[model samples]
Target: METITTFGPLTPAAEIAAAFPSSVQGKNIIVTGVSPNSLGLATADAFACQSPANLIVTGRSYDKVEASITSLRSKYPNIQYHALIMDLASQSSVRDAAAKINQDDKIPTIDILVNNAGVMAIPALTLSEDGIETTFATNHLGHFLFTNLILPKIIKAAQRSSTPTRIINVTSFGHQFSPVRFSDINFSKRAADLPTAERPDLEKTEFFTGSSHAEDTYYGFFSYAQSKTANILFSVALNQRLWAQYGIASFAVHPGAVGTNINRHATPSEIEQALKRAAELGFDAASKTPEQGANSSVLAAVDPGLSLVDVAADEVTGVYIADCRVDDANVARFATNGHLAEKLWSLSEGLVQQKFE
Candidate 1:
């Protein structure tokens, strides 16, 4: 297999797609959060450039999804495009969307599943309809359930294809902001109130934990970070459970900072604060275009070079990818913890009220 040794942060998605045409051509691909000018649409466009048999793009709004599909149709007239309305914050919507995809004759299997839709830095301590923290619910739980519900399709695809079926969870380097608050995931308890041993180190600092009061302790960016951490842990657990038995490989990707609406919920000061912290950690803190952000995901989705590695021996399952290659230095230790991964899997199963082996 040829290696993508030269791929980097600035590499275009089309160039990466061109490297492994066989991995994407004639395959079924699905990307979430595909509104205009978003990373999801960019990823879909990348796959379309490779002649995928069916490209499914999903979003919370019908009109937006249709608009995305229309855009793809205009740009890639020969590729078949489908639209799905999936509000990841709602489990019912996710289930409905999954059923529709499963029953659709056109989408026999899902070759690549990109859990790309996410909300960042929600200004308030809002809860989803399911009563879970809004960011956690939408970013992690929703994709957790949706992916499991569609696993059969992915498994079927794995069985038919020689290469491993891929699941790319779009996480952010902001995962460095915090780990999963297992004891107080809803932010109902302040750091000071928690048992000294159980309190997270970051929460001890006001910079990470915004408010001193339990009721007002919800910092939007920290909550978003927790959910992003869950995305990586979920990928770990999914790969650990399915790789040996099903040939399904999962990856967590940090799609470099891109100027997109995912930041709409944050105030200018909040954005500045986040970037300041990122720079303090020695991160580049530089922004990329939507197409550049999509490159990491595109590589994780179809890069044949990844398939040649020994997942178990190399501990490749749930490996984090950045700038189109495996890069774990930026990931928090907790995000890659196997025990936390399993614990998260159980918690997710209980939350969704569905169990998967």
Candidate 2:
């Protein structure tokens, strides 16, 4: 049994970014889901202190966007900040935001794109405006569409720059709960959860794939896990394309157990139940502070260790990061399947009705 390991008391993102001043100085970076207190804000805030030429923060509401920008501006007056209105559940909103970002004259290039905004299990079956499952749409499809649309600016930044630009996807270990479901990727087909005792196959294989893992009784936990798996696979696919074409890099990180408002949509009963389950799994007491949890994301974004000449030799792009370090095989086997990643990419392009690759 792989015992659940308690990730450490990590160095805060501010401390980590201070060590690598050259990496972020005078660069353009964008972080999504930058509410008052979030992993995304912490990541962007750390870089802001380093005097980035442009730091963009985005959220679903204009009020949250302005509030975050206001708060960060108070702390780092020297940093140039921009706010964008984005709603990950709507493909049209994502496209509009991307178009606005691309046309901004002040933000000519994109040095880093941190896909850090995500929603947790809402404990219900809700669909986005595009008819896709809400959890899957916000967590995976939105970032997929956003990245493809903004990749040109990223490529431009990398081509005429001294360092490689990055696309960072903040995923989670819940990805181990399931794999990409090819037959019922959207949860439109067979949807139901089987009791653990009844599903003997689940006992044999620690991780199960496909619609078999979805909720028949509306088990939102599994739904969130499946969406997270999509995040990892997308990072794998995007990493391949970025490296081959633009000499850029993409990475995914399991930003260790953090206390945040991602569970805002969960009902009180659902929240209590989740806490109880986390306690049973030894995950509750092991949680890191929001700032500490943001360390892995900051590390993935700008760590001198990742810029070594030997980094590419190790194929660091497709790997997953945890505890502020990259681990070769911490992710499930399916996450590394190139063919499957490509298939998911194709499915994602179809969902958004746009093809940028």
Candidate 3:
């Protein structure tokens, strides 16, 4: 089991970025889902500035991928940044992406793998080609498969590098919604948490395609929350496996409620109301730019100070960290019960089947 301390309410991302250390300057790092833009893109951009040996940024849209390459090149003309197109929701696309990375001659290994790409709150019961729910497929399963396929390379890099390699998963605090439903993940036999009318307004927005037909169609929010929880569980299980053997650790981060393309999936009315609420709360989503939202991720992945933690004497493995601190309450169950994490991982592994090794 892993044990970690909770560091809540981190300084704003912008404030942190101003004085942030550039630790990934010579490392080989990969940040996926950087095309559409958001905190993830900002995070990728931040890493580019560090001048890594190879910065592989990926996204689904070819045009967006091209645009990201163009933008990054203009800003950091000398950095070696490569952009690839891949659909994480599809197992085939993820496999092909990993295969291409494995075959690359430019670099022998990857020092950091930031699983920063994700979707949010779409009110539809969509399915991947493999027939799994879209949210579950992209947000959790895709990263799960991606990480394992590249584990050997990551391990090798850690062995050769000065600092240990790490995995920083970009997730949301909304994971508090519900525990992972080990018995039925697809919600095939269960009712959704939010009602149709109460769900985010998808009718007025043309954001990403949802998993169901309507807000109440199945409970997109509930599904989203559940998938995020699964993400935390995955982190717990992943850290448990890697910490002892590889000296590699994992972390989960919530980008602190920034307004991004995620609203593209919500109804226009919902978007308006959300923005209005943000205004009323004096909570500036703009306060933490994507670059800043990605600060903790940057710190977690490459910061040397973070390496001083006593991994051998203390059981800090597989703990959820937000805003640059440990969050055990957020993951107490998995920390205390390896069986539950193993159970969930086994169930998900079975569902993904051939997609995994």
What are the Cα lDDT values of the candidates?
0.83, 0.74, 0.67
TM-score of each: 0.92, 0.85, 0.80
Q: lDDT per residue, candidate 3, 190-257, as tens digits?
A: 43444332233343222322233343435666577667777776766777678777778777766766
Judging by lDDT, tell me the better candidate of 2 and 3. 2
Best by TM-score: 1
Candidate 2 per-residue C-alpha lDDT over 112-178 given as tens digits, one digit per residue, 9 for 90 to 100: 8899999987767788999988888999999999888988899999897785478888888767656
Measured with C-alpha atoms, the lDDT of residue 213 in candidate 1 is: 30
Error of 2 at 234 (Å): 1.1
How many steric overlaps are in each model, in order? 0, 2, 13
Q: What is the lDDT, from 0 to 100, of the residue 21 in candidate 2?
A: 79
**Worst 10-residue stretch by lDDT in candidate 1?**
309-318
Instruction: Quote model 3's TM-score.
Output: 0.80
Screening candidate 2 with a backbone cut-off below 3 angstroms (N, C-alpha, C), the clashing residue pairs are 192-216, 193-216
- State candidate 1's TM-score: 0.92
